[model samples]
Target: MKHPVTPDGRYFVVRGRLWRMSNPKLDETQRSKLTNRLMSARRAVRAAKTANDQSAEAAAHRAVDDAKRVLGERGPVWWNDGSPDLNRHLAKNTPYAEWYGQIGRSRPGGT
Candidate 1:
Protein backbone atom coordinates (compact mmCIF):
# COMPACT_ATOMS: atom_id res chain seq x y z
CA MET A 1 0.00 0.00 0.00
CA LYS A 2 1.15 3.56 -0.75
CA HIS A 3 1.57 6.09 1.99
CA PRO A 4 1.23 9.85 1.73
CA VAL A 5 4.41 11.77 2.34
CA THR A 6 5.15 15.43 2.78
CA PRO A 7 8.96 15.34 2.73
CA ASP A 8 8.74 18.69 1.02
CA GLY A 9 5.96 18.76 -1.50
CA ARG A 10 2.85 16.62 -0.99
CA TYR A 11 3.35 13.20 -2.49
CA PHE A 12 2.58 9.58 -1.80
CA VAL A 13 5.41 7.13 -2.16
CA VAL A 14 4.45 4.13 -4.20
CA ARG A 15 5.63 1.22 -2.15
CA GLY A 16 4.60 -0.81 -5.13
CA ARG A 17 4.30 -3.90 -3.02
CA LEU A 18 1.26 -5.99 -2.27
CA TRP A 19 0.87 -7.80 0.96
CA ARG A 20 -0.86 -11.07 1.67
CA MET A 21 -4.42 -10.66 2.92
CA SER A 22 -5.48 -12.85 5.78
CA ASN A 23 -6.97 -12.74 9.23
CA PRO A 24 -7.52 -15.59 11.63
CA LYS A 25 -10.06 -13.69 13.72
CA LEU A 26 -11.87 -12.22 10.78
CA ASP A 27 -14.33 -14.65 9.33
CA GLU A 28 -14.82 -14.56 5.59
CA THR A 29 -17.50 -11.95 6.04
CA GLN A 30 -15.39 -9.52 8.04
CA ARG A 31 -12.40 -10.04 5.83
CA SER A 32 -14.52 -9.34 2.80
CA LYS A 33 -15.90 -6.19 4.33
CA LEU A 34 -12.45 -4.97 5.26
CA THR A 35 -11.12 -5.83 1.84
CA ASN A 36 -13.85 -3.84 0.18
CA ARG A 37 -13.14 -0.90 2.45
CA LEU A 38 -9.44 -1.06 1.78
CA MET A 39 -9.99 -1.22 -1.95
CA SER A 40 -12.37 1.71 -1.85
CA ALA A 41 -9.94 3.76 0.23
CA ARG A 42 -7.13 3.03 -2.18
CA ARG A 43 -9.24 4.15 -5.09
CA ALA A 44 -10.36 7.26 -3.30
CA VAL A 45 -6.82 8.26 -2.38
CA ARG A 46 -5.79 7.77 -5.96
CA ALA A 47 -8.69 9.80 -7.28
CA ALA A 48 -8.07 12.55 -4.79
CA LYS A 49 -4.43 12.84 -5.76
CA THR A 50 -5.21 12.67 -9.44
CA ALA A 51 -7.77 15.38 -9.08
CA ASN A 52 -5.40 17.47 -7.05
CA ASP A 53 -2.70 17.20 -9.66
CA GLN A 54 -4.16 16.47 -13.08
CA SER A 55 -7.32 18.48 -13.36
CA ALA A 56 -8.22 22.17 -13.17
CA GLU A 57 -8.89 23.52 -9.72
CA ALA A 58 -12.63 23.23 -10.11
CA ALA A 59 -12.57 19.86 -11.81
CA ALA A 60 -10.00 18.59 -9.35
CA HIS A 61 -12.18 19.71 -6.50
CA ARG A 62 -15.04 17.84 -8.10
CA ALA A 63 -12.91 14.72 -8.42
CA VAL A 64 -11.95 14.97 -4.78
CA ASP A 65 -15.58 15.50 -3.92
CA ASP A 66 -16.55 12.44 -5.89
CA ALA A 67 -13.77 10.45 -4.26
CA LYS A 68 -14.86 11.48 -0.84
CA ARG A 69 -18.40 10.58 -1.78
CA VAL A 70 -17.16 7.12 -2.72
CA LEU A 71 -15.38 6.82 0.58
CA GLY A 72 -18.69 7.24 2.39
CA GLU A 73 -18.49 6.48 6.10
CA ARG A 74 -15.58 4.05 5.96
CA GLY A 75 -12.99 6.78 6.32
CA PRO A 76 -12.46 6.52 10.05
CA VAL A 77 -12.56 2.75 10.21
CA TRP A 78 -9.16 1.57 9.13
CA TRP A 79 -7.13 -1.61 8.94
CA ASN A 80 -4.21 -0.74 11.16
CA ASP A 81 -1.32 -2.98 12.22
CA GLY A 82 -2.74 -6.06 10.53
CA SER A 83 -6.03 -5.93 12.40
CA PRO A 84 -9.34 -4.15 12.21
CA ASP A 85 -11.39 -2.83 15.05
CA LEU A 86 -14.84 -4.19 14.38
CA ASN A 87 -16.08 -2.17 17.29
CA ARG A 88 -15.43 1.11 15.50
CA HIS A 89 -18.55 2.98 14.50
CA LEU A 90 -19.47 5.61 11.97
CA ALA A 91 -22.16 6.77 14.36
CA LYS A 92 -22.63 6.95 18.06
CA ASN A 93 -24.72 3.79 18.15
CA THR A 94 -23.50 1.91 15.09
CA PRO A 95 -20.66 -0.63 15.02
CA TYR A 96 -18.80 -2.29 12.20
CA ALA A 97 -20.30 -5.58 13.20
CA GLU A 98 -23.81 -4.18 13.08
CA TRP A 99 -23.18 -2.55 9.74
CA TYR A 100 -21.14 -5.19 7.86
CA GLY A 101 -22.12 -8.38 9.69
CA GLN A 102 -19.92 -11.14 11.14
CA ILE A 103 -16.47 -11.91 9.84
CA GLY A 104 -14.42 -15.07 8.86
CA ARG A 105 -17.22 -17.03 7.22
CA SER A 106 -16.66 -18.90 3.99
CA ARG A 107 -18.39 -17.49 0.97
CA PRO A 108 -21.61 -19.10 -0.18
CA GLY A 109 -21.47 -22.31 -2.25
CA GLY A 110 -18.36 -23.80 -0.74
CA THR A 111 -17.56 -27.50 -0.69
Candidate 2:
Protein backbone atom coordinates (compact mmCIF):
# COMPACT_ATOMS: atom_id res chain seq x y z
CA MET A 1 0.00 0.00 0.00
CA LYS A 2 1.12 3.50 -0.72
CA HIS A 3 1.88 5.74 2.24
CA PRO A 4 1.36 9.47 2.70
CA VAL A 5 4.32 11.70 2.03
CA THR A 6 5.02 14.83 4.01
CA PRO A 7 4.55 18.23 2.40
CA ASP A 8 8.29 18.78 2.18
CA GLY A 9 8.72 15.32 0.58
CA ARG A 10 11.33 14.45 3.14
CA TYR A 11 9.41 11.54 4.61
CA PHE A 12 6.50 9.18 4.18
CA VAL A 13 4.24 8.17 7.02
CA VAL A 14 3.67 4.51 7.87
CA ARG A 15 1.61 3.41 10.85
CA GLY A 16 1.69 6.98 12.10
CA ARG A 17 5.48 7.09 12.10
CA LEU A 18 7.74 9.10 9.83
CA TRP A 19 10.26 7.34 7.63
CA ARG A 20 12.83 9.26 5.63
CA MET A 21 12.42 9.27 1.90
CA SER A 22 15.19 8.75 -0.62
CA ASN A 23 16.96 11.67 -2.22
CA PRO A 24 14.56 13.11 -4.75
CA LYS A 25 17.47 14.66 -6.62
CA LEU A 26 18.65 11.21 -7.68
CA ASP A 27 18.15 10.54 -11.35
CA GLU A 28 15.40 8.10 -12.21
CA THR A 29 17.82 5.57 -13.67
CA GLN A 30 20.08 5.62 -10.62
CA ARG A 31 17.12 5.36 -8.24
CA SER A 32 15.76 2.39 -10.11
CA LYS A 33 19.09 0.60 -10.04
CA LEU A 34 19.59 1.18 -6.33
CA THR A 35 16.02 0.07 -5.60
CA ASN A 36 16.56 -3.14 -7.52
CA ARG A 37 19.73 -3.87 -5.56
CA LEU A 38 17.93 -3.18 -2.30
CA MET A 39 15.18 -5.63 -3.20
CA SER A 40 17.69 -8.30 -4.14
CA ALA A 41 19.51 -7.87 -0.84
CA ARG A 42 16.21 -8.14 1.04
CA ARG A 43 15.44 -11.40 -0.74
CA ALA A 44 18.86 -12.71 0.13
CA VAL A 45 18.17 -11.93 3.78
CA ARG A 46 14.95 -13.94 3.68
CA ALA A 47 16.62 -16.85 1.90
CA ALA A 48 19.44 -16.98 4.42
CA LYS A 49 16.95 -16.96 7.30
CA THR A 50 14.97 -19.82 5.76
CA ALA A 51 18.16 -21.85 5.33
CA ASN A 52 19.22 -21.26 8.94
CA ASP A 53 22.55 -19.86 7.75
CA GLN A 54 23.68 -17.26 10.27
CA SER A 55 26.77 -16.22 8.32
CA ALA A 56 24.83 -15.82 5.11
CA GLU A 57 22.18 -13.83 6.92
CA ALA A 58 24.78 -11.50 8.33
CA ALA A 59 26.29 -10.94 4.94
CA ALA A 60 22.89 -10.36 3.41
CA HIS A 61 22.04 -7.90 6.15
CA ARG A 62 25.21 -6.00 5.36
CA ALA A 63 24.27 -5.93 1.72
CA VAL A 64 20.89 -4.55 2.60
CA ASP A 65 22.50 -1.85 4.71
CA ASP A 66 24.88 -0.92 1.94
CA ALA A 67 22.06 -0.65 -0.57
CA LYS A 68 19.97 1.46 1.77
CA ARG A 69 22.90 3.73 2.58
CA VAL A 70 23.59 4.37 -1.04
CA LEU A 71 19.92 4.96 -1.72
CA GLY A 72 19.90 7.64 1.01
CA GLU A 73 17.41 5.75 3.12
CA ARG A 74 19.46 4.60 6.11
CA GLY A 75 22.41 6.95 6.37
CA PRO A 76 22.48 10.75 6.24
CA VAL A 77 19.40 12.87 5.75
CA TRP A 78 18.93 13.64 2.08
CA TRP A 79 17.52 17.14 2.58
CA ASN A 80 19.96 20.04 2.91
CA ASP A 81 17.64 22.23 5.00
CA GLY A 82 19.45 21.65 8.28
CA SER A 83 16.38 19.99 9.67
CA PRO A 84 16.90 17.22 12.20
CA ASP A 85 16.32 13.75 10.84
CA LEU A 86 13.05 12.48 12.23
CA ASN A 87 13.00 9.05 10.67
CA ARG A 88 11.06 6.46 12.66
CA HIS A 89 9.61 9.08 15.00
CA LEU A 90 5.93 8.85 15.83
CA ALA A 91 3.98 11.39 13.80
CA LYS A 92 1.87 12.42 16.77
CA ASN A 93 5.02 13.40 18.66
CA THR A 94 6.70 15.22 15.85
CA PRO A 95 6.07 18.42 13.88
CA TYR A 96 3.64 16.47 11.73
CA ALA A 97 1.19 15.93 14.55
CA GLU A 98 -1.36 18.48 13.36
CA TRP A 99 -1.22 17.37 9.76
CA TYR A 100 -1.41 13.70 10.68
CA GLY A 101 -4.38 14.41 12.95
CA GLN A 102 -6.18 16.04 10.06
CA ILE A 103 -5.63 12.93 7.97
CA GLY A 104 -7.31 10.74 10.55
CA ARG A 105 -10.20 13.12 10.93
CA SER A 106 -10.78 13.18 7.20
CA ARG A 107 -11.07 9.42 6.94
CA PRO A 108 -14.41 7.69 7.43
CA GLY A 109 -14.84 6.29 10.97
CA GLY A 110 -11.49 7.76 11.95
CA THR A 111 -11.27 9.18 15.48
Candidate 3:
Protein backbone atom coordinates (compact mmCIF):
# COMPACT_ATOMS: atom_id res chain seq x y z
CA MET A 1 0.00 0.00 0.00
CA LYS A 2 3.03 2.23 0.12
CA HIS A 3 2.66 3.73 -3.33
CA PRO A 4 5.20 6.53 -3.51
CA VAL A 5 5.04 8.58 -6.66
CA THR A 6 8.31 9.09 -8.47
CA PRO A 7 9.98 12.50 -8.72
CA ASP A 8 8.24 13.15 -12.02
CA GLY A 9 4.95 11.84 -10.57
CA ARG A 10 4.67 9.69 -13.65
CA TYR A 11 5.13 6.44 -11.77
CA PHE A 12 4.52 5.06 -8.30
CA VAL A 13 6.63 2.56 -6.44
CA VAL A 14 5.05 -0.24 -4.46
CA ARG A 15 6.77 -3.13 -2.74
CA GLY A 16 10.02 -2.23 -4.47
CA ARG A 17 8.36 -2.16 -7.88
CA LEU A 18 7.74 0.87 -10.03
CA TRP A 19 4.39 0.98 -11.79
CA ARG A 20 4.01 3.22 -14.84
CA MET A 21 1.33 5.87 -14.44
CA SER A 22 0.63 9.04 -16.37
CA ASN A 23 -2.29 10.90 -17.89
CA PRO A 24 -0.85 13.54 -20.18
CA LYS A 25 -3.68 12.99 -22.63
CA LEU A 26 -6.06 14.61 -20.15
CA ASP A 27 -5.99 18.34 -19.68
CA GLU A 28 -5.79 19.69 -16.14
CA THR A 29 -9.46 20.62 -15.96
CA GLN A 30 -10.71 17.37 -17.43
CA ARG A 31 -8.34 15.28 -15.35
CA SER A 32 -9.31 17.04 -12.14
CA LYS A 33 -13.00 16.57 -12.90
CA LEU A 34 -12.55 12.88 -13.54
CA THR A 35 -10.34 12.48 -10.49
CA ASN A 36 -12.92 14.11 -8.23
CA ARG A 37 -15.63 11.89 -9.64
CA LEU A 38 -13.47 8.82 -9.18
CA MET A 39 -12.79 9.75 -5.55
CA SER A 40 -16.48 10.21 -4.88
CA ALA A 41 -17.19 6.82 -6.43
CA ARG A 42 -14.52 5.22 -4.28
CA ARG A 43 -16.03 6.77 -1.15
CA ALA A 44 -19.43 5.50 -2.18
CA VAL A 45 -18.03 2.02 -2.65
CA ARG A 46 -16.50 2.13 0.85
CA ALA A 47 -19.78 3.27 2.41
CA ALA A 48 -21.95 0.73 0.61
CA LYS A 49 -24.03 -1.54 2.84
CA THR A 50 -27.72 -1.90 1.92
CA ALA A 51 -28.70 -4.31 -0.83
CA ASN A 52 -29.15 -1.44 -3.24
CA ASP A 53 -25.64 -0.33 -2.38
CA GLN A 54 -24.26 -3.42 -4.11
CA SER A 55 -25.50 -2.15 -7.44
CA ALA A 56 -24.39 1.33 -6.47
CA GLU A 57 -20.93 0.04 -5.67
CA ALA A 58 -20.80 -1.74 -8.99
CA ALA A 59 -21.75 1.49 -10.75
CA ALA A 60 -19.14 3.33 -8.72
CA HIS A 61 -16.54 0.79 -9.75
CA ARG A 62 -17.48 1.36 -13.39
CA ALA A 63 -17.01 5.08 -12.88
CA VAL A 64 -13.59 4.46 -11.38
CA ASP A 65 -12.70 2.19 -14.29
CA ASP A 66 -13.76 4.81 -16.79
CA ALA A 67 -11.79 7.48 -15.00
CA LYS A 68 -8.71 5.30 -14.90
CA ARG A 69 -9.07 4.56 -18.61
CA VAL A 70 -9.29 8.24 -19.40
CA LEU A 71 -6.26 8.84 -17.19
CA GLY A 72 -4.26 6.32 -19.23
CA GLU A 73 -3.80 3.96 -16.29
CA ARG A 74 -6.07 1.33 -17.78
CA GLY A 75 -7.03 0.20 -21.31
CA PRO A 76 -3.88 0.79 -23.43
CA VAL A 77 -0.62 2.02 -21.93
CA TRP A 78 0.45 5.63 -22.12
CA TRP A 79 3.96 4.86 -23.30
CA ASN A 80 5.03 3.93 -26.82
CA ASP A 81 7.82 1.65 -25.65
CA GLY A 82 7.56 -1.79 -27.28
CA SER A 83 8.26 -3.68 -24.07
CA PRO A 84 5.53 -6.07 -22.98
CA ASP A 85 3.48 -5.23 -19.91
CA LEU A 86 5.07 -7.00 -16.96
CA ASN A 87 3.01 -5.30 -14.30
CA ARG A 88 0.81 -8.32 -13.79
CA HIS A 89 3.67 -10.65 -12.87
CA LEU A 90 5.92 -10.70 -9.83
CA ALA A 91 9.61 -9.93 -10.36
CA LYS A 92 10.44 -13.38 -8.99
CA ASN A 93 8.52 -15.06 -11.78
CA THR A 94 9.16 -12.73 -14.68
CA PRO A 95 12.33 -11.85 -16.61
CA TYR A 96 13.70 -10.29 -13.43
CA ALA A 97 13.57 -13.67 -11.69
CA GLU A 98 17.26 -14.17 -11.42
CA TRP A 99 17.94 -10.64 -10.26
CA TYR A 100 15.32 -10.75 -7.56
CA GLY A 101 16.54 -14.06 -6.24
CA GLN A 102 20.09 -12.85 -6.12
CA ILE A 103 19.20 -10.21 -3.55
CA GLY A 104 17.32 -12.38 -1.10
CA ARG A 105 17.03 -15.87 0.31
CA SER A 106 14.53 -18.28 -1.17
CA ARG A 107 10.99 -18.16 0.09
CA PRO A 108 9.66 -20.73 2.49
CA GLY A 109 7.97 -23.86 1.03
CA GLY A 110 9.73 -23.29 -2.31
CA THR A 111 7.40 -20.51 -3.27
Model 2 TM-score is 0.93
lDDT of 2 by residue, 22-105 (tens): 888899999999999999999999999999999999999999999888888889888778999899999899898898899867
RMSD of each: 16.3, 1.6, 5.7
lDDT string, candidate 3, 69-99, tens digits: 7777777777666655555455555555565
Candidate number with the higher lDDT (1 or 2): 2
RMSD, candidate 1, Å: 16.3
Q: Which scores greater on lDDT, model 2 or model 3? A: 2
Q: What's the TM-score of every candidate structure?
A: 0.30, 0.93, 0.62
Over 4 Å off in model 2, which ranges? 108-111
Go through the candidates in order and give each one's C-alpha lDDT.
Answer: 0.37, 0.88, 0.63
Clashes of 1: 7
Better model by TM-score, 2 or 3? 2
Best candidate (score: TM-score):
2
TM-score computed on alpha carbons, candidate 1? 0.30
